[model samples]
Target: MQNNEELKLALLIASIAMLMMAFFVISFVMYYQKKRFEEEKKISDIEKNYNRLLLDTALNSEETERRRIAQDLHDDIGTMLSLTKLSLNQLSKMIGTTGDEKEDQIMKKSQSLVEETILHVRRITRDLVPTTLERFGLLEAIEEFIDKLEEDNNLVISFQANTEEFPRQGQKLELTLYRIMQELVNNAIKHASCSRIEISLESTEEMIGLRVTDNGVGFDPEKIKENNLAGLGLLGIESRLAIVNGTVQYEKPLNGGSSAFAQIPVMPIAENKPEPLHPFRRERVNI
Candidate 1:
């Protein structure tokens, strides 16, 4: 009887030990999972904050650009037009019942000024938003932009479109994509000092790709992330891509230049979808 009691006690102790071991193993797993979740949450929060900052920067930059353009129109082109009108009004008062040679000369000069002002207004409007992109399509708009750039100087831009038609990514996507290319071209002109630029548009089953290659000194992606003075262009590109669910890759070739490749994923446009409300929409706010 004593032996049987001892045997039973030993078995019970062993079982209790196994049970404690199992409990500890489960507790450790739970703790590990909780820790992992916390870490992931922190990462997610960081991303959200970064994106928020990017959006704010983009919006502010856009507002500044718009204001500058508006001021140019009001102060420069608008002033010229107003002066032309004043000149015509003064000339009309000087006109007598008979034609004068001096009057004819003044009229011709005023007409020339009017023509010059019209051309300037058209150029400014085109720069603000290309009418070709809206009316004709992206391809034509790009070609026109490149032609204008080439006309200005040695900024030789070679453009090729692999597809005949652009993917149906909605108007907003089209405009955003155009703006991205526009910004890239301006950056290449102002900062890169690139003489030769090659642009290619390609479409795949998954996404649309835009590649701009410039024969100029390359830039460091790290410097862009660090927000250096020379990296504002890259920063703008980053902000644009973030908003559009796009990706950008920058590479430097052995020939000593930079290449920028941007890819935008194809998203299906929902039918009869309501327009998204802008979060920062306001009637007027004094800055």
Candidate 2:
């Protein structure tokens, strides 16, 4: 009887030990799974934050563009149209006068005003979205833009490129890159006070790169990093670049100027690419 009691006691102890081992294994697995889930959640949160930033930047950019267009219409074309209307009213008053040289001159002046107003409207429309960019491609469009700026005789711009046979990378990429370049040029003209500017484009097997250098007062990239919202132009560039999986670097060159370099990695193009963005097609959502 004593031997049997000892045997039963030993069996009970072994069973209890096995159960405890199983419990420990389960606890370990649960702990590991919890850690993995937390890591995934962290990554998800980071992505969401980045996407929100992009959306906000885009909205701000759209608002800025709308204000610029409105100002152009009100200050430029609107004023001219008003003056032309006044000229027309005067011309109407003297229409019945006989062989008056002054009346003839007024009519001619009115015609000239109408023509000038039409030209101004066309120029504003072109700036909103260049037809050359839509049809001839990015390089030609940039060349034409530079040529127009040259006509103003305010600054000298030089363009160098290896883009004669550049492949179509879809409209989003093209438009984003073009806008970045345009913003950089505007900054140089408005802030840099640079006399000479250089723009270059190069392509490789997997990427396209653009560099813009100016001989002007250089900027501190650190300031942009610290306060991105300080300059809408820079913020807009970064957000647009993020959308296309591109990157930009800004530096104050040792030779006394500012330089910006951008690289856009190429992805496999779909057989059916989306249509290029058109000025009229874009919605101007007001904030």
Candidate 3:
């Protein structure tokens, strides 16, 4: 009886020791996994910040170059063309039609060509750098752009804002939004084959939203992802929105067509603070 009792006690002690060992091993594994996960997340966050910095630098450089080119076109090429036109006018006046029909026609044609070239240069300059956007604000700039488009194309484009007196967001936010709008409109016109487009801009205390709806052939998001049918336009839109910490979504309206809505979180600018020169330099809000 004594031997049996001693054997039972030994077995129980051994079992308890094995359980304690198993518990320690599991605890160590779990702790190591948690630490490893935390390290990976830290590394990932660092990489994202680095990439964002690079993107901001690249975009800022591009905008600066664009502004430079626009200025040159306006100051140099545009001025030179105007002067040539003036000179032609003087030459025509001095000659006063010497009964040379061919020469008269040639002079008239030369003046017309110069005027046309000047108009083209002005249009290109406006496209490269939207002066109206800088001077007036986003709403006015967009209205002017849409009006011009309507005049030039057979399509009907309508724009509506939440208010007549839309408040100004900073220059960077405004420009980024303007560019995104331009891209959306261009894409709709080129790809959607829509006769009419409706664009609405809404601003609230927390966020600013833009919605573009068109009655045309819509697209499949999955197919676009698989086949890359979106081309660079979609990518450009994404990048611009990313810079502003905004998001865009596409939906197929039940009536037949597609709509794109983009939202950017708004941060109220301090009344006394000056707007930053670079739009990308503004504080970002994670969506």
Candidate 4:
């Protein structure tokens, strides 16, 4: 009877041990499940946010393009039509041309107007189709952009390509970079009020860096953020660089002025130019 009691007690203890073990296993499973649930939730949130940002960027890009097209049309075609109308009006006013007096004078004025309009139209069309970018490559295209800036703004610009060549990359990325540079330089002229602009492009085996500097009234980045939100020029640039897997950083010089630096990881190349591709059909730029 005593031995039976002892066995009963042993069995009870064993059962209790097993029950505790089972409880622990259940706890562990519940903990694991909860962790997995949290991880998946976080991932979902990230994906949703990413999609939202992409949509916003696309819409903004479209709006910007529409504005640019409007500009080209207004600057080029509108100018031509206005001059043509003026010419015709001048001719109409000079009615009753005796021999070659008024007719010659009116014709001369009209010819001059027509010539100016043609030149304007051709210029706008060429900007729409800068075949040089494909035929000449990035360096040459940059030089041309600089020359055009000088002519339009009367601003002195200096540029240097330290790598001697640009690497093979997605066309969109290249175009984005070109536009970024253009935007940066344009902003300096319009707002910075700087007399000189310096540009440098350097590359390493795994990365390329671009720096544009101007000795102008440098503003604090933190201050700018507090003052404005959407209208910030560099904000759009930051978004644009992200689309190309690149970065843009702002630097306030120790002495004076400001510098904008951008970098992208890329394999280095030494060719004088990239392989020719189809011409860059100028998308009507956003204003």
Candidate 5:
């Protein structure tokens, strides 16, 4: 009888010990899995930050190069063209219609060509750096751009802002927004076969929003994403918006058109801050 009792106790103790060992093994596995997951997440976050830094650097470098090129065009080629135009005017005066109709016509055409070229250079410089964006705020700059686009093309573009008085966001954010707008507009023009576009800009306490709606053949944003079929224009817009910590969404309106909406967080403007300078008000001219 004593032997039987001892055997039962031993069996119970052994079973308990087995259970304890199993618990320990399960706990270890779970702990190990959690640590592995944490390590992978950390690595992923580090890689993402590194890539963002690289992208930011590349974009900054590109902007620097743009500024350099714009300055060169404006100061050098622009000056030379102006001088050439002046020289032509002086030559025309000196030759004074000595009954040489052909010579006079040639001089007039040469002057016209030089004037057109000068305007072209100015346009290029403006596009490269967007001096209007620097001097005026984002709204005015975008309006100026739209005006130019309307003057050149038959497509009608309508712009609306929440207010006439828009507070100045920082230069970097404004420029990024402007570039994104340009990309969206260009994409619509190039691919959408749209006749009319509606653009809206709104500013609130926490965020700035831009929406562009076009009456054209719409696209499936999800399909584009799944197939990795986004063109360079879409990719460029995404990259620019990402730099500014902004987001963009593309959707097809029920009315059978496409719309792109972008939003960026911004701090509330200080009332005491001075207004932006609109030194040279951009005049709408036929390009």
Candidate 6:
């Protein structure tokens, strides 16, 4: 009887020990899973924040540099060029040679050089800051731009305006659209064999659409995809649209030409929450 009782006790002890071991193993596994999940989550959040900061900083820095360069050209270089032209005029008047063709030639050369300088400075300023876009909203500026492109590039640029006003898109979106149009027109002039190109804009309640069509010797999308990537002009347009949460499609239209279309978000983008305003925060540049 005593031996049987001891055997039963030992069996109970063994069972309890096994149960405790199982419980410990399960607890360890649960802990490891939780820790792994937390680690991954932390990594993901860090990457997301890093990307946001990088994009914002890049855009902001670009704007700052543009403003600075435009101001310098307009305020400093423009004034000097004008003053130099005036000085040349005064000198020509003082050195009055009685109808000397040689003097006239020198004066003409100076005048031409001065004109070129002024024109170049103006061009640089316009490129840096589209004063028209700021003053006359987007539609009028676009029309004016097309007119300039016609005179400057000698390319038959056609633009059809579907909307007279686009108030909801705000200045940022309008600027992007204007810049993209400028880029497309430039690309057409440089690469597209066709002289005529078409630009159209349509807007609905939900989104805005832009179409750029060229009657050029259209290249296959698959074969020339490498060229498109290498130039980065196409990639640049893609990136800009992406910032505004837009989509771009490249195709050949029924008229036997290449067409690129973009649709962008019209509604306001969601605002991100600012990082915690801690007392220890410093003017530390993010590397």
- Using lDDT, give the best candidate's number: 5
- Give candidates' CA RMSD values in order: 6.1, 5.6, 4.5, 6.2, 5.4, 7.1
Ranking by TM-score: 3, 5, 6, 2, 1, 4
TM-score of each: 0.69, 0.72, 0.86, 0.67, 0.85, 0.75
Would you list the rank order by lDDT, best first?
A: 5, 3, 2, 6, 1, 4
lDDT of 5 at 74: 77
How far off is model 2, as Cα RMSD? Answer: 5.6
After superposing candidate 2 on the true structure, give the runs of residues whose Cα lies further than 4 Å from its correct spot. Answer: 1-97, 227-229, 273-287
> What is candidate 3's CA lDDT for residue 274?
40
TM-score of 1: 0.69
lDDT of each: 0.73, 0.77, 0.83, 0.69, 0.84, 0.74
Instruction: Report the C-alpha displacement of residue 61, candidate 2, in angstroms.
Output: 10
What tens digits encode model 6's per-residue C-alpha lDDT throughout 1-287?
A: 99999999999999999999999999999999999999999999888667756664775566556666777787788889999899988877865656777887898799889989999888777776676776666677778888877877757878886866656355557767877887877777777787789999889877888888898876556656755553667776776676677887888767776788888878663265322212122222111
Q: Kindly report which residue stretches of model 4 are placed more than 4 angstroms away from their true locations once superposed.
A: 1-103, 126-130, 226-232, 267-287
Error of 6 at 73 (Å): 1.4
As for model 3, its CA RMSD to the true structure in angstroms is 4.5
In model 6, the worst 10-residue window by lDDT is: 278-287
Error of 4 at 168 (Å): 4.8
lDDT, residue 238, model 2? 78
Q: Give the C-alpha lDDT of model 2.
A: 0.77
Q: Pick the candidate with the highest TM-score.
A: 3
Q: Any idea how many clashes model 3 has?
A: 0
Runs off by more than 4 Å, candidate 5? 1-17, 267-287
Residue 154 of candidate 3: its Cα lDDT?
Answer: 96
